[model samples]
Target: MFVRIVKMSFHQDKIPVFLEHFHSVKEQIRNYPGNNFLEVYQDKSNPGIIFTYSVWNDETDLENYRHSDLFKEVWTFTKTLFNDKPEAWSVDKLVTLG
Candidate 1:
C-alpha cells in the first residue's frame, strides 16, 4: 500500500469554507479508483493547519488521481484558501500495531 500525507495552512477565516468543501467531496475522493482510505485532521495548536492522510494502491494510482479532473477541481478551490504552500509526502508503511 502507498500512503500520502499533505499539510496545508489556511487563512483562519477560510477554515470553515475549506472544511465545508472537504466534507462535500471527501466521499468522492475516497471512492476514486485505487484509493483505499482518506482522512482529514486539524492541528491541535493551530486550527488553520490541516492535514490529509490517504492510502492508495501505489504511486501510479496516486499520480493518476493527481492528474484527474477531480483533483484539478479540488485543488483549484483549495489552493485559493491556503495561507502557506502545502507540503506532501508519499511513503511506505513501516509497521502498524493493534
Candidate 2:
C-alpha cells in the first residue's frame, strides 16, 4: 500500500465551512474502492491548516479517485476556500515500528 498526504491552508473564516463540507463527504471518501484508510488532522498551532492522510492499494486506485466525480465536487468547493495552494505527496511506506 501507499500513503497519500495533502496539506491545505484555508482562510481563517473558511475553516469551519471547509470542515463542515469535509464531515459530510468523509465517509463516502473512506468507502471508495481501493482506499484502505483515511483520516484528517488540523495543525494544533494553526487551525487554518489541515492535512488529510490516506492509504490506498496502489497509485491506480488513487488516480481513479482523483479523477472521480466525487473528488471533482469536493475539490471544487475546497479550492475556493484555500488561503494557499495545496500540497500533496504520495509515498511508499518505508517501515513501521511499534
Candidate 3:
C-alpha cells in the first residue's frame, strides 16, 4: 500500500470550521477507488496543528484522486483556512506487527 500524510496548520479559530468542512466531504473522499483508509489527527498540545493520514492502493490511485473534481472543491475551501503551506509525503509501509 502507499501511505500519504499531509500535515496542515490552521488558524486556531478556524479549527471548527475546518472540521465541519471535513465532515461534509470525508465520505466522498473515502469512497474513491483504491482508497484504503482516511483520517485526521490533531496535535495533543496544539489543536490547530492537524495531520491527514490516508492509505492508497498505489501512486496512480492517489494521483487520480488528487486530480478529481472532489479535490478541487475540497481543496479550494481547505486552502483558504491554511495557516501555512501544507506538507505532504508518499511512503511505503516498512513494517506491520500484529
Candidate 4:
C-alpha cells in the first residue's frame, strides 16, 4: 500500500475557495482508480493550513491519478490559492492503528 500526505497553506481569504473546490472534487478523488482512502485535516491554530491524507494500492495507481485530467483541473485551481508552496510525501506504511 502507498500512503500520500500533502500539506497546503492558502491565503486566509482563499480558504473558502479551496474548500469549495475540495468539496466538488473530493468524491472524484476518492473514487479514482486504486485509491483506498482519503481524509482532510486542518491545523488547530492555522485555519488556512490544511492536509490531505490518502492511501493508494501502489505508486502506479497514484501516478495514474496524478496524470488524470481531474488532477490537472483540481490542481490548477488549488495552486492559485496557496500562500506557500504545497508539500507532499508518498511512503509505504510502517504501521497502523485505530
Candidate 5:
C-alpha cells in the first residue's frame, strides 16, 4: 500500500473557502480508483494548517490521480488560498498494527 500526506498552510481567512471546496470534491477523490482512503485534518495548534491523509494501492495509482483533471481543477483552486507552498509525501508502508 501507499500512503500519501499533504500539508497545506492556508491564509486564515481563506480556510472557509478551502473547506467548502474540499467538501465538494472529497467524495470524488475518495471514490477514485485505487484509492483506499482519504481524510482531511486541521492542526490543533494552528487552525490555518490543514492536512490530507490518503491511502492508495501504489505510487503509480497516486501519480495517476495527481495527473487527473480532477486534481488539476482542485489544485488550481486550492493553491490560490495557500499561505505557503504545500508539502507532500508518498511512502510505502513499513508496518501496521490493528
Candidate 6:
C-alpha cells in the first residue's frame, strides 16, 4: 500500500469553513478508486494546522484520483483557505498499530 500525507495550515477563522467543505465530500473521497483508508488530523498545540493521511492501493490509483474531478473540486476550495503552502508526500508503511 502507498500512503499520502498532506499538511496544511489555514487561517484560524477559515477552519470552520474548510471543515464544512471537507465534511461535505469526505465520504466520496473515502470511496474513491483504490482508496483504502482516510483520516484528518489536527495539531493539538496548533488547531489551525491540519493533516490528511490516506492509504491507497498503489501509485497509479493515487494518480488517478489526483487527476479526477473530485480532486479538482476539493482542491479548488481547499487552496483558497490555506494560510501556508500545503506540503504533501507519499510513503510506505514501515510500522503500524491500532
- Highest lDDT among the candidates is held by which one? 6
Model 5 segments more than 4 A misplaced: none
Q: Flag the better candidate by TM-score, 1 or 5.
A: 1
Instruction: State every prediction's TM-score relative to the real structure.
Output: 0.98, 0.96, 0.96, 0.97, 0.96, 0.97
In candidate 2, where is summed lDDT lowest over 10 consecutive residues?
88-97
What lDDT does model 3 reach? 0.94
Please report, as a residue range, the 10-residue window in candidate 5 with the lowest summed lDDT.
Answer: 84-93
Q: How accurate is candidate 2 locally (lDDT)?
A: 0.96
Of the candidates shown, which would achieve the greatest TM-score relative to the real structure? Answer: 1
Residue 91 in candidate 1, Cα distance off native in Å: 0.7
The parts of candidate 3 lying over 4 Å away from their true place are: none
Colliding residue pairs in candidate 5: none
Tens digit of per-residue lDDT, candidate 2, span 1-98: 89999999999999999999999999999999999999999999999999999999999999999999999999999999999999999999889899
lDDT per residue as tens, model 3, 6-91: 99999999999999999999999999999999999999998989999999999999999999999999999998998999999999
lDDT of each: 0.96, 0.96, 0.94, 0.95, 0.95, 0.97
Clashes of each: 0, 0, 0, 0, 0, 0
- Residue range 1-98, candidate 5, lDDT tens digits: 99999999999999999999999999999998899999899999999999999999998888999999999999999999999989998888899999
All candidates: CA RMSD in angstroms?
A: 0.5, 0.8, 0.7, 0.7, 0.8, 0.7
The lDDT of model 1 is 0.96
Colliding residue pairs in candidate 3: none
Better of 1 and 2 by TM-score: 1
